[model samples]
Target: MAADEPTGTATLRDVARVAGVSPSTASRVLNGGGRAVSDDLSVRVLAVADALGYVSNQAARALRGQRSGVVLLGGDPRTASIAAMGAGMEEAGRERDVAVSITAVGPDAETHLAALRILRGLRPLALVVTSASFVGTDRELILAELEAAHREGANVVFIGEHDYDFPAVRFDDVEIGHLVARHMASLGRSRPAILTSAGHPAMEGRTQGFLEALAAAGYERDAIAVESVEISREGGRTATRRLLERAEKPDMLLAGNDVLAIGAIHEAHEAGLNVPRDIAVSGVDDIPIARDITPPLTTVSLPFMEAGRAALAMALDGDDQADIHLQSRLIIRDSTVPA
Candidate 1:
């Protein structure tokens, strides 16, 4: 080794020595000890550690009874809501000086469990799970993994709907359906169809609410039709085609999400139906593209970012056992109501 070069991996003591701080103070700044450190001292210690290439041993820190300064978020990043939630969590993490790691949880039982194991191995201070739906033995096994992680000193927080005994931030999925149903009724839409993917509890809850509201409005229970398809634009298109093929076609289409709504609109146009004139369409999750389409889509705008912030706050010890319900509202656009 060069005379002036480091001979071995930099330790906490080495960092303290180079930064002119005490070993205990260095530990407080780097080891997530939960003790307050002066900003100047923290900055200097971090700079020295970075200069020395000091990589934190998270497992060692955990063994020593210190939590890692990381928050692990498990969700599918492909969806717009999850993406927005991640951005919100990142913003909150920056404010709290904590790091955020987003891991994609698979849609299936086996892959989901594997992802949970990986997250547990990371030993984050907090684990936030979202955009997942499991049932029967799969649900039980996944819950066990989460409980194990929680017992090992990680804060477990869930976003979206789950009956598990964990801190959760949930959206008003039923109310989301009610909003669409109420809007449709206001527009004098009598015959309606729902486009959604099966096996999703959140979507199912919304559909239930929609059905209840439609029933209360004096619509026959059998009058409404629900089509289950893949949760994609093509899926929406296929479902819409099937509904449009019926002898007494639906006058309005209610999609479980904006993506499906987009497909429904496309299919309606392809069949030479004028949106909001010949047929009306509405969806949940007001994604960016909702407004940019030829005739902007009417959708329920969800507070994904707020939900993200709330989830992170809970993970950071805000309130662990409480169920936080975020509100979503309806946005009227050309898709459902013509200009």
Candidate 2:
């Protein structure tokens, strides 16, 4: 609200507001995408804008001796969380006057290689390789690709590392598991079941820490049971059914993510469970919908937005920069403890 401060960030709206026209009208005339405005009329508007020093702020900008080359954001399109991350980071890229080119890598080797080659041909400013979730094989492949990109002097930032590492912006799922476990234990949850997908670093790490924490807290090693399934609502529903059918049902369920947690909640209702009284539930990733659930999920908070912001930061880091890992925390809601 300061007098000297600009009213708003430079955007199409500002351009239109200044030119005294609708944003769509300004867009049509400026981009020449739709209707072509009269040459003289367009010239007069542009002249007035030039006099007013009005400049359109777009993500595409030219760098010194080069156009801001496309930065490759490579990931699996099926990976929902990674898609969110890419969307968030793209905004950061725009703020920094860089263009982001996202490419979805397929499962097949031929398809992945072709996509990789095409991305390389773009002469990208850098390549940020990430996984929606990490499995051992995928992590190794991802790390290898990042190493290859690094060797080629392509700015490389890898997310969710398994073995090899490079410049990274990641959160610790292991720590998240530990936090959730300790919280549940403190609330008298001795034997907890973890619902998560197997084959990925996120699930694997969290499961490992959950079990380890249980043992460390003086519980039997076999006391913790993990139901490995796909990281989706349907997957959680299936896994929860199997878990509930066990000889002795678990006292608590720790879902790997909020979506799975939501599924588990619904499953509990189907199984004639009384939630915290019959079996408490918790999850990782305090997604937007987490708070809207019946018991309001007790879950760990992943810094997803922070991860995206960190990606752009890594992209802009100085040469010889190393990786950075952020920690996750637990958000204890009604689902895990007695009031």
Candidate 3:
């Protein structure tokens, strides 16, 4: 090799030499193959491999009929929550020596079908679905793809929805709603209203839980008003404005997520109503911004990052069938406190 050319690409032999281990031992540890190797030896080999910028030869592995260490993630990347989950998955993948590839798909039928087809073609070690729901009315096509992946020895994991038989990592959305509602009720906010995304299964489940808990807390059905909106700040603002126009205004507004809750706060300010005094507001999904906003927003904290990591672990390490349910806690903040 020319002196100007980078020293020949680092190899497994170089990693083994630097770590003082045999090439076979290094291979077993680094490749995650089933070979009895000491934890200390594995750690040393991995450390040396990282320091040397060593990468396994994919072509050679292919020739040896080894499966690629790739995890495929499908979701709408534009959403902040989904984006965060994807980042968490990537971090977990690096730690496990696996590759994660994300594909953004719209909420349309054609896009979802195309994404599923592409996922089937990749035949990755695992497939993670982070979208709210699959494309089209029927889930047959997506379910078929999942079944195909499973038959080929690939794992399938869903983030939110539990429509399929595959393993899933999901938050207890119903419980989240119940917690937030109970909090509102404890504050003596008997008149409550909910603003939520239209046609979202998880959000719908949360709404159902909230209404049930509110009713159990002596809030009559006639006293509650639930509005389905576009799942945005503007939608929340618009819906809250309508609610404010009513003669008997609600004392508490429950938003499906933080974005909507923030919008509700904005509308309250514009209407010359003081939050927590005129109307207390709360939302779900304790996003980063939830804590930064004025009079920090009270909400349900879903372990989204933990869910991402758990999904990866379930896909790569757990049994063929696993169900991981994460908890959501009520985060009490200034927004929900009565003046």
User: Candidate 1, residues 254-337: lDDT per residue as tens digits?
Assistant: 898999999999999999999979899999999999999868999999998998888888898843467999888889998886
lDDT of 3 by residue, 1-339 (tens): 321112246776788789998766776677655247888888889889788877665433445564545554554576668767776776676555566667775566667767767766755777788647563324676678668877887777889866667778878778888888888889876679999875677788789888988999999977799888877789889999999998989989999889899999999999999887889999998888899987799998887778778888887874566578887788999998763
List the candidate 1 regions with Cα displacement exceeding 4 Å: 1-65, 69-75, 131-137, 318-320
Global lDDT of model 3? 0.77
Flag clash pairs in model 2.
134-200, 134-201, 135-199
Ranking by lDDT: 1, 3, 2
For 1-339, candidate 2 gives per-residue lDDT tens digits of 221112244455556677777665555554433235667667655665455554443322222223233353544654445666676666566545455666766655455656767765555667776755233334455456656656665676666644554577767778777888777777676567888776666777878777777777787877677788877788888888998898878878878788888899899988998777888888887877888888899988777666766777687664467677877777888887642
Q: Considering TM-score, where higher is better, how would the candidates rank from best to worst? A: 3, 1, 2
Give the distance in Å from residue 260's predicted Cα in candidate 2 to where it truly belongs: 2.2
Worst 10 residues of 3 by lDDT: 1-10
Give the Cα lDDT of each candidate.
0.79, 0.68, 0.77
Give one clash count per candidate, in the order shown: 0, 3, 0
Q: Compute the lDDT for candidate 1.
A: 0.79
Better of 1 and 3 by lDDT: 1
Q: What's the residue-level lDDT of 248 in candidate 1?
A: 86
Residue pairs with backbone atoms closer than 3 Å in model 3 (clashes): none
TM-score comparison, 1 vs 2, better candidate: 1
